[model samples]
Target: MSNSIATWMGKGHAAVEAPIGDDGFCFGSEPSLADVCLIPQLYAARRFEVPLDACPRILRVEELAGRHEVFGSAHPSVQPDAE
Candidate 1:
């Protein structure tokens, strides 16, 4: 990968491993901004083959979001304009 690409992916990896709940945001409730961002990011991470096992909070949030009806609403396949 190019230096820029490596740097970018490195940043993402850092984000995935960073501590959660460190900013006083409640994750026990409905998903927050971090949860929202992490979903698509993890999707990309999987496609890009980035190691995410270190990001426990993201996996937990994703697993929780995956279990609920609310997550379905945000699915691209279910979008009103989706193909």
Candidate 2:
């Protein structure tokens, strides 16, 4: 499981290292479907204790998304039922 997680995160890291723009999103300056999907996957990765030290671009995207009003509001941690 750890190996698989590392492999996938490594792939994601490589993919985003160059393409991620100054806005820190997966695609463009504004959040899009890719961001919506990426954010949740990042959340899940954190929950599962997946190490993200090498995925700086992914982390940057997550941070920027968390600051967006819509995305911030929709975070699982902010839900009423969250523990």
Candidate 3:
């Protein structure tokens, strides 16, 4: 499980490292559908204790998304019915 998480996150890290954009997001300055999808997976990764020390780009995207008004409000933990 740990190896699988590392492999996937490594792939994600490489994708984000490309010349996608100057902004610290999965694609560009603005959050897109990719960001929407990636954020939850990142949340799950953290929940599962997946080490992210090497995935700086993924972490950066997660951080940027966290500050976005839409993403911030939509986070699962912030939902009205959340435990």
Write down the lDDT of every candidate, Cα atoms only: 0.64, 0.79, 0.76
Ordered from best to worst TM-score, the candidate numbers read 2, 3, 1
Clashing pairs in 1: none
Full-model lDDT, candidate 1: 0.64
Q: What TM-score would every model get versus the actual structure?
A: 0.63, 0.75, 0.74
TM accuracy, model 2? 0.75
lDDT of each residue in 1-83, candidate 3, tens digit only = 58787677767656655644555687767888888888888777777677778666777888898888999999999999988
lDDT of 2: 0.79
Clashes of each: 0, 0, 0
Candidate 1, residue 77: lDDT? 61
Pairs in steric clash, model 2: none
Write the residue-wise lDDT of candidate 1 on 1-83 in tens digits: 35565457658767655666533222546667767776777666665666666666666667777776877688666888976
Q: Which stretches of candidate 1 lie over 4 Å from their true place?
A: 1-7, 22-26, 77-83
- The parts of candidate 2 lying over 4 Å away from their true place are 1-19
Best by lDDT: 2
TM-score of 3: 0.74
